[model samples]
Target: MKSSEVTSLSPPPFSQVLSMPTSNQGWPEDFGFQLGGTGPSYILSVEEGSSAHLAGLQAGDQVLEIEGHNVSTLGPQAVIAIAQTQKNIPPSIGVVSRIQQV
Candidate 1:
């Protein structure tokens, strides 16, 4: 079977929205999640007990949108830049959670 056929046979990824509020300092790190990826930025890690962790963000979650901006085709830096633009308000992050198949 082709790679496309194999991919099609797998279940589709599910999406979830995370409302993460930044700290008073308003920095990307304050959001408690590390982002990494070139195209389609993804969450590298979620700090324990942090806003992102509480908001249900997990490592490997593919970022679909950030603060209402589509980031599906953006690099990590661009995505982080968009995230940094938000101040005290909680930014709505759209993510696709992929489940690893055994």
Candidate 2:
């Protein structure tokens, strides 16, 4: 994907979205961005068939928000925790800043 081709998309939630694959990190099967780096949590990669990838999330995109809150201050754990609390993976929105060219 080209960096110049960033797209802001709200991918439709699929029926497969569930807590079937729970991560040891306390996240469900919905959001699949690997968190890491120096300061803020940056998207390392998006799983090919994950809900996050289907939602237009890309590797290198800066995670700006989780749900309706800006997690830049609260951090990714707090954001991820929200997803962990749901029985059924609820619809959560992520605001990422990246332009993909794929």
RMSD to native, candidate 1: 13.0
Candidate 2 lDDT by residue in tens digits, 1-102 = 656867899988775743435443335333566765454666777788776777787777776665656666445566566655545544355656755777
At residue 101, give the lDDT of candidate 1: 57
Q: For candidate 1, list the clashing residue pairs, or say none.
A: none
Give the whole-model CA lDDT for all candidates, comma-separated. 0.76, 0.60
Which lDDT tens digits does candidate 1 get at residues 19-77?
Answer: 55434335447777788888978888988877788889999899998777889999888
Please report how far candidate 1 places residue 3 from its true position, in Å: 66
Q: How well does model 2 score by local distance difference test?
A: 0.60
After superposition, which runs of candidate 2 have C-alpha atoms over 4 Å from their true positions?
1-30, 86-88, 98-102
TM-score of each prediction? 0.68, 0.54
Which candidate leads the pack in lDDT?
A: 1
